[model samples]
Target: MANVYLKEAIRTMETSSGTAANYEYASTSCQGWRNTQEDVHLILPNFDSDTSLFAVFDGHNGIEVAAYVAKYLPEYIRQNRKYKRGRVSEGLKEAFCLLDGQLLLVDAVNELRAIRRQAHPELPEYKPGITSGCTAVVCLLKKDTFYCASIGDTRCVLCRNGKAFPLSIDNKPDDANECARIMKAGGEVVHGRINKLINVSRAFGDHMFKMVPNMSTIEQMIIPLPDVIIEPYIESTDSFMVLMCDGIWNSMDNSEVIDFVGSRIQKKMPLAKITEEVIKNVLPKEMPPSGIKGKDNMTICVIKFKGKRGGVGSTNMSAMPRTTVRGNNGPNKHH
Candidate 1:
């Protein structure tokens, strides 16, 4: 087994809540059984007058990449030409690829080390290169629609009249499409993991796997491409949505999670409590040494849509993007 597990789990949580034009949201994160807390999230309840953005970055190897993405991704997305032209979906995909490319440069690598320095002054072993990476799952609310962009195992689920609808596909090496890409790049998938190292097929950072001698970034063994999904909103039928990392999914299925959160909503439980409670209920009592599904970092973002009677059609899965602005990444507040 890997040597990243700690003797004890960290239960302390970082929680926040906010409201947007049509929904209210709350997010919670815990370090859990990992050696350190590498997961970080961004909540943009009012990204603009009509748009909102929520994202979770599940970092691997270190927290620097996740932290960097949380703080600067919005700016990069906004700066993209497609985003400026109202092509939110296209902008999101390009922004992800563009940012991953930037992270490989010397300046970007140095900045990542600086972020780590700020978080952990005692652990100064981040050398002059970048090997860390993060799985990003983002939910964008614009008008009466939802656009989700994701890479890796982090997921977004829509609850429609107590039913569950997955918005994004989990990119894994074992999946046929992902497997083909890896094999085309001359990389081997051993035991479901990429080169017996990372499990997810795509993510930010991780320049080591991405550096193929003469291949373009997208043609590398591991790329930064994201699968985007577009879902039309039906306020009458859709109740809420959940965006979380593999930590929560490892313990519960899509239906189980919708039911758990739905029942709590019926009782008028606060959104923040529901988020924290899910983590508390799903966290393993005794994490296994392998740390596959159990005892990993956990993060959950709950967005509840306000009822308005008559509604619309089913959720759609497609490629997408969103608008710009700074977000509330603080505690007890979301604006």
Candidate 2:
């Protein structure tokens, strides 16, 4: 079985929110019915003088990979040469791969051991290998634009004038481009899963799938490349943006989610409350639709731009489903 549930669900919610230059945000996560909480996120409202960063990570096998990424990705992005050279797009793309490369078990031994010793000196530090991985959805508010980079199905959506405009696309194994890459790497998409082991075509870590002879990093069965989407931050129409994991998307589509969050904001509900209600609204009381993955770990990040209209009141941007390539889903997940 790919999923596990606790005897009883954990209803407690972890929430965070803050304000930056022209941006304000709130994020929340729930352990739900899962045996353990594997989702993680980061909220840096004042990342720098002119920019801010927000992201969500959906851990697959465990939380180690997601937690590590949540802790290190910002520093990695900040240090990338391309980003330093003013090529933000290239910088983000390279940063994802660079970070993933550091996860190679053979090379991470010293690093992981050192980190583990410091975090939990009494706990065991030995592990066979790095088998865990996570889906990443990152959003960087740079000046007057939004840069969203993502791998796997985690997503970032912008609510502009009450409309849903997805910033990052879902990278499922069933997707054409994703499927093609998997096949070319001698991997198969079994029941929409990569080699019947994972559902996402791209992710951070998951080193088990990266093994193959004579293949470049991008040619691996599971790559770390991220799709970066750029959208201008228009104050008049763009209200707010939503960055969420599959847990949230599993139950709500772009329209329903945008409208759901918007209606709450219109009622003047707090951002943290809006996020908590979203998880509560979709949390199942019994076996989830498919028996495979029942209730999931839920996470959401909302970024607001104080504007003339303010997302349905926060993020109403311009882009249709096709134009933005929001994406497709399959069983073991949602469609």
Candidate 3:
């Protein structure tokens, strides 16, 4: 039997905004039974201009990559000139790409080595060929608008009118476009794994899969390009948003998670407690057939929008506009 390594402790963080929208947010991370916690999250309520930014980074092979992204991605977004000019979509895209490039720098590797030495002196020094990466799902809310950027399998779902609307697409080898891109870059997808090793087709800091020559960053085998989605927040219909890693998705479908969260919100439960409950419901007590139970680190973030009257669905319903931004692909406009 595989020894069960349980990090049953759960960590929670929360903040509230005094802005006109009265947005409140809560987040939690549970190491689960994994030997190491490889998940990291960010919560920046009232980031700027009454905006909030929340994200979850799920790391594989090591936690350094996820921790690095959580520390620097937000700074990159804030520093992007496009973001200051109100071109948030472009800003996010640029930020994702810029961070990926920074990861390949020699200084970045030295920093990682320093961090590892400080944290674990016994571990061998970080090397150039080291393999590590992370999946990122970020949600940015400004006024009545919501923007999301995702890479890899981490997901974001918006709960609207008691229904779950996926705000991000999962990047996997099974995806036709992703698979084609990989094959064109001299990479192969075998058993749903990219190059028979990495499960995600897109991610940040996987230098090993990104060694293809003469290929643009976006055309690399496992690129850092994120699919960006933008939506107008409908005060009346839209309830809340949830960001989580694949650990939560592996056990529950989108609708199941929505229903569970909706029931908890209806009971007036705290957002942090709601996440804790969701983790409890999904994490298995023992190793399952898939061997995924308790082996993956779980992280969740919840953002609650408080309307003028009070809770969600308290206002009138009206048609809202939506827009989605794709890399290389043309813009998808909706009403």
Who wins the lDDT comparison?
1
Q: Between candidates 1 and 3, which one is better according to lDDT?
A: 1
- After TM-score superposition, the amount by which residue 120's alpha carbon in candidate 2 deviates from its true location, in angstroms, is 12
Best-to-worst ranking by TM-score: 1, 3, 2
Candidate 3 lDDT over residue span 1-335, tens digit each: 33335435333323322223466777777777665577888888757866778899998766778888888998899989988899888888888888888887888887766665664364444452148789999998776677999999999999988899989989888789989999998999999998788889888888888878777788878888788898877777778888989988888888888899889999998877788888888766665555674457788777777764233254233554567776646222100
lDDT, candidate 3, at 125:
48
Better TM-score candidate (1, 2): 1
Cα-based lDDT at residue 217, candidate 1:
66
Candidate-wise lDDT, in order: 0.79, 0.77, 0.77
Residue pair clashes in candidate 1? 88-321, 89-320, 89-321, 228-318, 229-318
Model 2 residue 251 CA deviation in Å: 0.8
RMSD of each: 7.1, 6.1, 4.8
Q: Report the C-alpha lDDT of model 2 over 192-273, residue by residue, as the tens digit.
A: 9988889998898787787787777777778888878877776767788998888888888878889999999999998888
lDDT of 1: 0.79
Q: What is the lDDT of residue 110 in candidate 2?
A: 53
